[model samples]
Target: MKRIFDISMSLIALVVFCLPLLVVAVLVKLTSKGPALYWSDRIGKNNEIFRMPKFRTMRIDTPAVATHLLGDPDQFLTPIGHFLRKSSLDEIPQLWSILKGDMSIVGPRPALFNQDDLVKLRTEVGVHALTPGLTGWAQINGRDELPIPVKVDFDAYYLQNRSFLLDLKIILMTVYNVVRSKGVSH
Candidate 1:
């Protein structure tokens, strides 16, 4: 049932946002030196590694680390990068991940491949059994602001309480957070 919901919703999203996605792609290309889509090595379900695409919000020269870990993340931003991040437009390409079965519409957001501590903690708590997502409980709750352990705790909670209705609620809350630009530090 969850898989069906993810596929259906992701397909609809890809169709409805098609033109806007094109526009964003062009914007990213024009504002940055790298490809419009950035393929990141992200940790997925059961600790599997997968290539996840996001609209490139940072420059090609930017270090391959979490944005929060960068000493001066703003310095690496392409001209429109900050705007893309703030608006959450950079995440549009992740619909493809959902379509490809590497991600769900609602689950724990994937961790960067090098985030060992996060992976370990989530694994210890059995939160890594579920697939990663474009938006999740941690995202709507605090997003970039939450600490790793707390994020894993939220993931565990979602794993335990997952349901169609919970996913719907998370999706709606994600919409609200994205619209308000709340809780996103980067």
Candidate 2:
């Protein structure tokens, strides 16, 4: 049921946001030296690695580490990168991941491939068994503001309590959060 919902929603989203997606892609290309879409190695269901697509919000020269870890991360931002990240426009391409079944519309946020601490903690708590998401409980709760342990706890809670209604609630909250740019660190 969730998979079906994911596919249906993703397809609709791609169509609904088609023009904006194109505009973002163009802006990314015009402002940055790299490709508009960034393919990241992300940890998916069962701790497997899969490529996830995001609109490139950092420059080609940026280190391949989490943005939070980068010293003076803003220094690597392309002209429009700050706007993209703050507005969450950089996430639009992840609809592709949703369509490909590498992710769900609602689940734990995928960990970076090199995030060993996050992966290990999630695996120990069984959160790694679930498909990664474009948005999740942790996202709505604190997003980039949450510590890793707190994020894992939220993921585990979602794992235990997830349902059609909970997913719906999360989706709605995500919209509100994104619009308000709440709890986002960058």
Q: What is the TM-score of each candidate against the true structure?
A: 0.98, 0.99
> What digit string (tens of lDDT, one per residue) describes model 1 on residues 46-91?
9999999999999898899999999989999989988889999899
Question: Runs in model 1 with CA error above 4 Å?
Answer: none
Q: Residue 84 of candidate 2: its Cα lDDT?
A: 87
Q: After the best TM-score superposition of candidate 1, give how far the Cα of residue 112 lies from its true spot, in angstroms.
A: 0.5
> What local lDDT score does residue 2 receive in model 2, on the 0 to 100 scale?
90
**Top-lDDT structure, candidate number:** 2
TM-score (C-alpha, index-matched) for candidate 1: 0.98
Candidate 2 per-residue lDDT, tens place, 1-186, comes to: 899999999999999999999999999999879899999999999999999999998889888888899989889888998888889989989999999999999999999999999999999999999999999999999999999999999999999998999999999999998899898787
lDDT of 1: 0.93
For each of the candidates, give the backbone clash count. 0, 0
**Would you list the clashing residue pairs of candidate 2?**
none
Model-by-model lDDT, in order?
0.93, 0.94
